[model samples]
Target: MRGIYVFSDLSLHERLQKALAELNLQQPTEVQQQAIPKALDGRDLLISAETGSGKTAAYLLPSLHRFLATDAPKSGTRGLVLLPTRELARQVFKQFKQLSAFTHLQAGLITGGDDFKYQRSIFRKNPELIIATPGRMLEHIKRNSCDLSDLEVLVLDEADRMLDLGFAEDVLAIAENCRAERQTLLLSATLKTKGLMQVVDRVLRDPEELILSGARDQHGNICQQIVLADDRTHKERLLYRLLEKEQYNKVIVFTNTKAQAERLGGAIRYRRHRAGVLQGDMTQDERNKVMDWMRRGNINILVATDVAARGLDISGVDLVINFDMARSGDEHVHRVGRTGRAGESGLAVSLISASEWNLMASIERYLRLQFERRVVPGLEGKYKGPAKLKSSGKAAGIGKRTKGRGDKRRGESEAGAKKPKQRLRDQKSIGKRRKPSGNKPAGDQAGSGALGDGLAPFTKRR
Candidate 1:
């Protein structure tokens, strides 16, 4: 009720109230209400929710409130938030700065790209809040440039993704350095595997567990469609055709790799379309410019990798085209979720190749829904390529076709009759029945001596 603005008539901190009121944030998102209270109470939290559900504000508000509630002390690193990527750390730092504008909270950002000497100089000032990447933070700790002895709160944003990127060991090492009494908050879009739980135990106390349900479905307002692209050629053809015709004010194309993003951006630009690329390989200034162009509608088509796509708050992005399907089903959900946000109707188009059939299927399964498949009219053609799973092996009720020479044996009994009727049994017994395992002639094998070699010599002709 403290955070809920819709049903309950409750007030918040002056700054949060003013910002929420100004932004027309009429009510607390489910994640905020469920997690903020405990977070404010100084309990460790494990939260599993979807992106764009106001999860950032949920934790930020409570952390800021706790900072303000206490007496103002000399600034020191009291809170540390570890994000998976530099981009995400930057984005989260931005949000924290915006929300804490009224409060004199000094938040510093530590990531890989910036100058280390500059960062070390800022550390001398003792920032109260430090938002950083695991690798960079570890560097500071090793250099004895930063101290975690007074650190009270540790938040791991995008924990699942950090694990996916092979940062589990780094995360554990960082966790070991934090204060033993720290209130650890683990937040992720989706949580899987007990290994994640094991990490939780290593850092957190009994801690409060909050799983918000109302945030599960992000694509509710987005129209999703699957285009059947049997191969890469077909996929490209369909993508080209759609871009030529689809009416969208702004578009974001997602690719699996940085190189793919660059290539796709090049092709779109070669066609005279305003396009740009955003990936991790780009320098900070270059990435900022691309993001600015995208945000300003100066670039109508922006091709980006998943890192740039996560925690993205782009508005008016009316279309999202997945040029290269996501490697994981979870990533697929997050990719299309870029559009159709904030209750705005948008379109998501996936150019799925045969090799990606199972990836698409797994996505469908995760969303617990089926998508309508359509083919571009002029590009329909039979494609010959390597076999791909029709869907993930778990696609329900859609049986795979029998392959090799195993098809014939499926319905036949050991006797080789289509059906095991009594008449067939009597006939089989009278003449010949193939012995389960013997190389003798058919007549001798079935115990019928009259029919000499009975079709055995002819059967052996092959």
Candidate 2:
């Protein structure tokens, strides 16, 4: 399947083949070869493949072929692709347009930050396909602006990331609105993605489960490494050195927070590197511009957060630096997958400080891979690594985590500060302030006359 089947062998529409030729895509990837056949057969598919695999094309090609071959009227969106982020939706939309270049099938893009009226107009035109995020699509559905009754195919790309973004209910609502008779395809990077099976149970019907590549499957072409940094400043210096010394055409540095990404991007630019920042805070247009600049090689360095970079694929990104370690193995997989794409060689170096050592180790254990420890010649940190390690590669705690140890070191300790009394016993006067009724009428007892020490009757909510 790897090399035996090309796009021609899959019996795609001739025009589509022409477009593929123009894109120089002759041979089908493993995921594409396996999925295109089953998808063409109109089977519900649950595909678990590695990131940067040809999953997008695997689903898109079969869908476009079905649309192009059939002479049915385009009543509404015949195919719908639901992605986790606006970046992904844009990427898929770009690819769809490229593949359908030779045909008349139209695709609409819907996401959080676009014009609602324009999207409604897109629906009015009844395009053959719509690429959208779950949240915005649900908004359109609520407005009766989204048409799915004529939908023939449904795809959930990055299913796990959607669940992480808390789109489970929105997706279910959208699925409920779609015709159950339509074909469904769900793709995720990991099989053990939390709440992924629950979504599968409800959306897919007797689906053909395809595990072309699992999350644990290491990227053979990526050399993963770890650099110990004392702090963010240290990490920044290390990044500058990497950009100076490494042999990479393009590099991306991932941070955990949007603010960190912006700050890092600024620092990199201050070092005279053409860097760009991508995060949720930016408007869709800004983010799109940054991505455009990246693709055209106007900017070679991209500083981004995990959510913003989801499903992003750019060629020549040979180096990935985790300015901050990914919080989970699934995140780390996607972060590293940005490089070493399409069987190309890559280098992914994660900067791990003492606080992130265990998290990095946990990710290593989860992925069943070890990151090589590297050090800068003059910028090495004092905290080299752990003194003891668990069999799973996590840092072994000596005994107990000293209370306030971290806060103390960071000048945030509460030690020596007077403990403000917060217990009820510390305010016993609350009960003593009330007077006894002494068998008086209820109204009279609650009056001011019943107060002890002539205090007002605990009125005005104390």
Candidate 3:
């Protein structure tokens, strides 16, 4: 019933209502229903929702609502949103502009890889809301180009991701600099991350916890499948085949390394398809060009690293191919979630090599789901599913333990394998001690090169 709630029926001001009308945002998502009312109540909130769950609107609507209020003259930026990546920061800034389309309020973008002088000018303009990444925002804070003393509301988007990028201290320090009376909203897709809760405890003040969707439930509609491959060439063939065969308006292929993304980009381009590569090493201008191409449908395929996986909300990404599957289940969820978004059907396919089969199983176990085994007609790989499975249903890794290590270890452990190592010379009996030839007196043996301790006589090494 809550999912059926519409945006116009909610308490949003007419300005926002009109903007929502233009954005075609009529029905409130599950997250929006639960988060907006609490956010409007000026309550600090801790939310755990999937990516592309309308969580951005949930918080942005409330923050915009605050800006639309006619209560007090704005002192500084009344609202601040901190994200992990520049792309996500830009995405949120775009949405902020779209949502405030009907209002006179302004939102500024503060991120790295842009002209610092221009950002300082943006600070001088004193936008009502500032969307920034922690590092560059901290830089502005250090320069006094940015101030949060009069901040009214603060939102930390993808908080866990910020922590993962080693920004724990930076985020904490930024939160510390915000106005003490600010309403803080901390949102993260994966809540079980190590330092995420610590951040929640430190930043949010008695926040109401909002868990709208579990990680397992996030990608339920997306069809997940695994294609077995032998090696890199095999994978490339399979990928090229999929690109030709799969019917998709747009597709993103995720790889673990920038090098792989580059390689795949070239490979796809050679197949006569327009492809773009998005990674961390590229200049922001290059990245912007790629994303612009992506948005304009100039590029049908985009190869990217995990940098794009976290908080990006790209539309028409009907298919996701794991050229390289993610290292963790949380990351897999984010990758797959890029598709099948906003109640649209999508597909995610991962190419499993001999090396990646075990990782695939681990992710399956972690997510508590199974992947459909798919074989391409001419490009099927040698690496099918594993021959053995653990009692927990994960593929048994071909580890030392599985390779007769258990029995060998049992034999060794029974034979006192834990004992300290002994050199062969020390282990062998060279002869009896002979008591240092005490038959000869000590004084007589001293000149004979016997040890002063009288344990053994020195012999020349052959």
Candidate 4:
């Protein structure tokens, strides 16, 4: 078959090409164009590509081709894909199954929150491709239920997220169990973190470095906007209004907390929209069902926490509403990335309050672009924040502290000034007590107080 693109030439296996065609993938993505050929050449790869950039397939197709080309026994795992979350592992496994459809290569998923014995049963099948989370995979390794002795390729999908989730030790442990000569492919949304670099140094050898532009730049197709909300209630109203007014094929509302995700999902469902909740608190089976509902259009809206929705590939998500501003700029990027996938245009609206304005500004600075400020006509918020920003365009009230020496000295003087008034009141009380009463003499009073104390001592002893 002729190549679809200049880069997707004879380097890829014919079966892989047929699978790509069946998936309607006519051309290689930028990351795939750059990384796949080198990966096929048996080079250790460190790829940094934005979400929804076909990074999964970039690594998967090459690994599948290598497995199909080799005569090595499929008795032990040969290709290992380690992700940070169970959802990501399952999604990658699904992708692997799709790409390997024309070949006999088997892929198995092992993650926590699932039956270990059932996974071990899958392991007995001698799958060549293994998709798993670091923690669960490490458990299997320690239990002697899974073996990586014959592992040829180790793919760390979302290495940065794994490190964020504190899976560094687990990932390194799994890598240690794999053969030293294994080809390590590390893929991340960003590779600037020290932890990811350390993993790269430990696993990859003279790796081919491919760093694509960040998600913010790549997601220009997403129309970003900011809605000013006075408070949580106002944000909720704005969210409901947006959902009611705007037309979207499918929408994802992102919240910072699982509680908030559940609340918002419930609220949306109560409003008569088919909405589903995806958060860390949900069981693996429940999460899978929610994802299935979202994918199959049973639910038109999905409210999800950041960690739960990371690396999820749901297509045709037309709009993303950040119900709560993301904790960081990177998080904001990933939250919005759930939409505008695969060259489709999408919309992202972040509901920002007075407290979240600074966060929104930081994300704007990180992305090097300003979000268009929007308002609901009748439902305009009272907290519009600073009328004018600093020269850097960040929110004006932030990064300014009132803890200088002058303020400290002022506070000290105020506290010190109050002491004199207290001392004066004490002096007045002493003077009043010293003033002689009509019925008693000063010496008599002292003698009487002393006598009363002596009597009290005797009474207490009794």
Top candidate, metric TM-score: 4
Candidate 1 lDDT, tens digit per residue, 1-462?
324345133335776666666666677777777887788778889898777778888788877777777744864688899988877787788888778877788889999889999999878888888999888889998898898888888999888778877788889998888888778899977767337877887878887777664223557778888786776666767877888899998888888888878887888888888999998799977887887888888888888999866778777888999888777667876787778765688898887666666677777777777766666788875743224334444324455776755755764555475764567556664666676654557657676644464543433334
Best by lDDT: 2
What is the lDDT for 342 in model 1?
A: 56
Q: Candidate 2 at 31: error in angstroms?
A: 0.7
The segments of candidate 3 whose C-alpha lies over 4 angstroms from its true place after superposition are: 1-3, 395-462
Query: On lDDT, who's better, 1 or 2?
Result: 2
Per-model TM-score on C-alpha atoms:
0.79, 0.85, 0.85, 0.86
Off by over 4 Å in 4: 1-8, 397-462
Query: Candidate 3, residues 1-462: lDDT per residue as tens digits?
Result: 355778876799999999999988788988899999999999999999988889899999988888887555558889999999999999999998899888999989999999999999999988999999999999899899988899999999998889889999999999899999989999988788888888888888999999877787788889999998988999888999999999999999999999988988987898799999999999999998999999999997999999999888789999999998789888899889899998898999999887787788888888888899899997766676668989766677675535576788789989875877878988787787655443766655566546565566677889
lDDT for predicted candidate 1 compared with the true structure: 0.77
Candidate lDDT scores, in order, read 0.77, 0.89, 0.88, 0.85
TM-score order, best first, reads 4, 3, 2, 1
Between candidates 3 and 4, the lDDT winner: 3
Model 3, residue 43: displacement in angstroms?
Answer: 0.6
Residue pairs of candidate 2 with colliding backbone atoms: none
lDDT ranking, best first: 2, 3, 4, 1
Candidate 4's displacement at residue 166, Å, is 0.8
